[model samples]
Target: MQHTVIDGVDVYWAQGPAPMIATLTFGCGVRDESFRTLGVTHLIEHLAMSTLPRLHHEHNAMVDIEVTKFFATGKPAQLVDFIAAVCEALSDLPLSRIEKEAGVLTAEGSSGCHPTAGVLLARRYGIAGPGLAPWDGPGYDRIPAEAVTAHAARFFTRGNAVLTLTGPPPEGLRLPLPEGPRVVHDPVSPLSVDGPRWLAEDVPCVGMSLRGPSVSPVDAMGLQVLSHRLTEVARKEKGLSYGVDGDRASADSASTDRFVWVDAREGQEAEVASILWDTARELATFGPTAEELEHEVAGFREMIEDPRFVDGDLDEFARSVLLGEPYLSPAQWLEALAAVTPEQVAAALTESLRTALIVVPDGVRLELSDVDGKLVELGGCAAPEWQPQGKVFKPSLLARATSAAARGARLYLAPDGVALVDGGTRHFVRFADVVGVLARNGSRTVFGRSGCVVPVDSDLFKGIEPAIAAIDAQVDAGLVFPPSVFAGD
Candidate 1:
């Protein structure tokens, strides 16, 4: 109900306390060109933040398939000026030719040659998705500047914005008047559905999902605590993921569903999958546990049991917001967390985690594929000379098309070429376009740009030692690693 126009967009600023929180929401239109330009909106987000020199410190940005969120924290006095700058930038949008070029370079610096970068490259080259989606589809070509300009004008309209502020609203923190033809649209919460899919390249890769019935909206307080409890349960369980957590009604809409995820080891795929399914079954079969039922009635008291609750800090407020118990008094958060029962916890989990998605890092391509499974015994691939910028080897796990020569031995191949090698203490290599014996030794571990361990040539051992060691270690680890577990014939 609280609303006003600011610089051609709608503004909804709320009053709270010491440190204010502002949420400025805007509708971003996807056209036949934008989607193809992966991270275009993300790029715009960075640019907008950079443009606002006032709040350069607390900058953060997030982009989902549909929405993009930007937030910055600062003193109340400077809030208006900070927000004003954002409004100005949005209102007087710029899409100059020089700016587009600069944006491309910046995007490249961040993406490098990673596969994800392919999206941006496609966008630059005018690739459109499936058809002419609101957002561009996938392609690998440069997009014309004129098309970029047209896309910007259609979206970024004043009628498509929701700006909210949570803090001590300044006397003059009113919405800025607009000088445009655009009108504000009524808020329409987005609909989210799950068609969860997962893919990981490892021996133990697997995926699982389940769904349960809805819970009482009144019991929202218990939902947050239940997530923490479930996280603890999964973390302690063997073969379970290191993290398993969920949120109840994270979005403002009534139709939205809660979700949780489990990241676990490969072999535990079936076990963990069954556990998740049974957990949901337990919910419908039995109501809340005694502790869970009690916690719900107490109204989430344990959450705010913090000693600093009396001081009224930002951290406390954030906790309250996350708990979905924001309307409750500080005492209520503390009260609810303590009183929740096992039954209530179970019920909440049943409601929210009924439909769960489980992702395991198992490399099994399919449950069934016995077409004489091909193995690219990588130890047999041809080795390349250590030239500058040298040669790049595909992991032994990859299906190589050629054979390799390692120590005068011809490695075997099963469709995938150089199968995974087991180099006990020694290392190994699966060099570029090469098969088994590609390089005799394992390359030195060099840190990639992302600080990940990537193999490189060493001064000694001619790289063969490392390759052999790598394959041996795989064998010793007892993992059903790659197809090339055995040496080439």
Candidate 2:
């Protein structure tokens, strides 16, 4: 790959087939926003694109977990105009259009990865970082104009951006982004949990997340071979699943949470989950045959040797450059992949299987034997057995008289945070770790960085005023939002 610097931004390019393309990608994305400001990045992309003049050229923008891209394909002049306009818009975003764009985003709905992918991430890391993928958060319409300005200034600068091209840099190309320091993001951290466990979530398919080293050839091939085997057995033979796919998320600079998700055929969720579990166990215990290993290697070779993959290679390099991640050239990756053996694949799976998290549709249960023939049952995000050491408020007189559930609920308010106790189980979130707090009228729902939600509302208990007041006083003001007045009390 060829590289240079333009106006303080890194520029990378490669020679490829006709119909040249260019991408302006920044390191900031969904993971960078607070829970209250979840859709802020998507909104920024829309705000920038809204500034573009209508043209015949094919151009668009998109935002994902860790990068936002503004891409276009056309003559050199058109490409030049597209990026310049994007930088200008980002530098002076139309604050007046905040309400309009916010509504458009709210109507557009979910952002980032697929819902199943988000759910899998949330299950692993909670409602922060990669886990924030699945939620619309406090609602995009609630994002403040100041927040939007601050976010764009912090991330959409020349120092933090990378420009990639399928051809050499076009003449007169310039990145006019405001000068700012590069933002170094913390590596994503998984919630501290033990062992491989299966649990039910509201997802449509059966999914599994295995924690392992980032971009490891052995782990990648292990997942690839397993995916192919599942497609063969689950789809071709049993007809229990319609699609088998996978996605990956960075857990840290050196580790990743790789996923293998299978969408089931209605009443077949249980069977699909079982097949996924059993096949992974079988492959880990016995490894793949030589024939199976060769087939995947052929696929890798086709990609590595093909000139058309130049653009793909350039994009990967751009991501690595912007995020400061370790980059592996196509040749480097191919060499590593080609050298992988069945034993290495099996060993990788064997180790990652220990920290695997599997999710099935609600009410579906998984019963399986581990590689050692031990019956292992999966668990869900059950609350830890402990009570908040704080002031306790009993149920409201009306709640006690009207409902058993409300009668047994107790609200705890501590200097550090809050919790709700119901049926001897506690749901809690500390103010110090809050990702977001949704406020409506006098009611507030606290969202913890660890994925717990504690509602300090009137319906659950009495004397809720103090709890609500405490929340407002404790959490950062910027991390709290009233979604909408029309959302009701």
Candidate 3:
């Protein structure tokens, strides 16, 4: 692949066979959005491609944690036209269909499945910045055309984009992109908690996550080998899980997040968690075997050598470039992988364990008392007293409820906010902080801005419906999405 700069945008061109692919990527995604404007990038992406004519080609758009990409694959001429059209569309967005496109985004989000990266990142980084997913998107109803346009102006610019093609450059490829300064993603401030903590969710799977320094080729290869080893032991040898895999996400230029997970049967969650941790501990102690490393490296080399593996089209490279990571060729990457020793993998594993976070199937507890002191909780520091506006409700609970009684708990609802007063501490959630209120299984739960769930267990609190209604009233109608938004359709 050859690299050039056209009108301040980085361009990568490669020669390949028929059915060429052209992609225009911008450094704008979920990480660029604040909590109030969480899904604007996605909304802009959907709108930008809304007018593309689908003839003799296939076109699509994708918005992830850190980038938005529009791509088309077909004849070279069609691909060139698609790229030019998308750039023009971005330059002058058709906001006339804002509501229609938002509805489309809402339907898409409702049917979407949450990835493990979002779930774990929300825990590790909190919900404010790059860790915005795992929580419901900002209500599509609340987003206006002005907000979407403003977001597009900030991110969808020439300087912040890279156009990559896996075919000869098309003649008359006019990329009339918007002009703006290159966007530099600010470093995310991770939550203030020493981790390797444990969290149990309602899903029927067990996942363990670890964070470490920026990804090196060796660390990447080591994680691949370790994931394979765990999968072999957990899924093939013991028949304990249906699938086991590992994935990584970039937290910033300085750090990377690694996740290893296993999907098991309903009754086997604890066992799965135990085996996962045991495997992690063992791997951290001894690293992968030479045979395992060799096998994984071979697989890696094969993927790199695949005909479809266009270096410029790699999501990793796209993200890395935005984060200012040094570029390495496939051969250079292989050499680095070969140089990785078991001791180095072990050391990397050890560093990862220092701040690991284990997410287990809900209602299942894994014995992690040894790491209890390092556990992190969701939400920011306590809100000062002045934030509370008016008292809306104070529900009464049964006397035998020890969890609530012990803390002198009271549900305090206000016009602008809601607070759960436990002893002298107040976990106050403003209406703006609320993502949604869920009423299911005879219980009412309010999800906060940081994805923390404040549950009012039916057995404990009376007069809960009114409290829920009152809280719901304060939230904008458009922002109150359903609970299934989190559950993939």
Q: What is the Cα-based TM-score of model 3?
A: 0.81
lDDT (Cα, tens digit) per residue for candidate 2, span 1-489: 788899989999988876888999999888887788788899989888887889899999898888899999888888998989999999889888877887777667756887777887887788878888997687767878888898998999998999999889999998899999888888777777766777778887899889988768889889999999999999999988888999887755577788899989988888888899899989998898888888888888898688778878888888888777778888787788788898998999999999888888888777765745644444434333445678898887887888888877888897788888778567877788888888876888888877788888876567788888898888888888886632432
Best by lDDT: 2
TM-score of each model, in listed order: 0.49, 0.94, 0.81
Q: Tell me the spans in candidate 3 whose CA falls farther than 4 Å from its real position.
A: 110-114, 311-315, 368-393, 396-409, 412-418, 422-426, 429-489
Tens-digit lDDT string for candidate 3 (1-489): 677777677788776556788888887777777655667888788788887876666888887766788988888788778988888899999988877776677677631124555667777776655577655554664566788888988889887888878866777777788888778777877765566677765544688778776758767866687677778877898898888877656656677677777888778888877787777778878888888778877987897877777734354566666657566777778888888888888888787787877887667766653333434432233243434345533445344445555336566666666666655556666777775565566665666654455565555566667666766677765544343332443
The deviation in Å at residue 405 for candidate 1 is 22
Ranking by lDDT: 2, 3, 1
Q: Highest TM-score: which candidate?
A: 2
Query: Candidate 1: lDDT of 448?
Result: 13
lDDT (C-alpha) at residue 198 in model 1: 27
Off by over 4 Å in 1: 1-9, 29-34, 54-57, 96-151, 168-229, 237-239, 247-254, 265-270, 296-358, 362-489
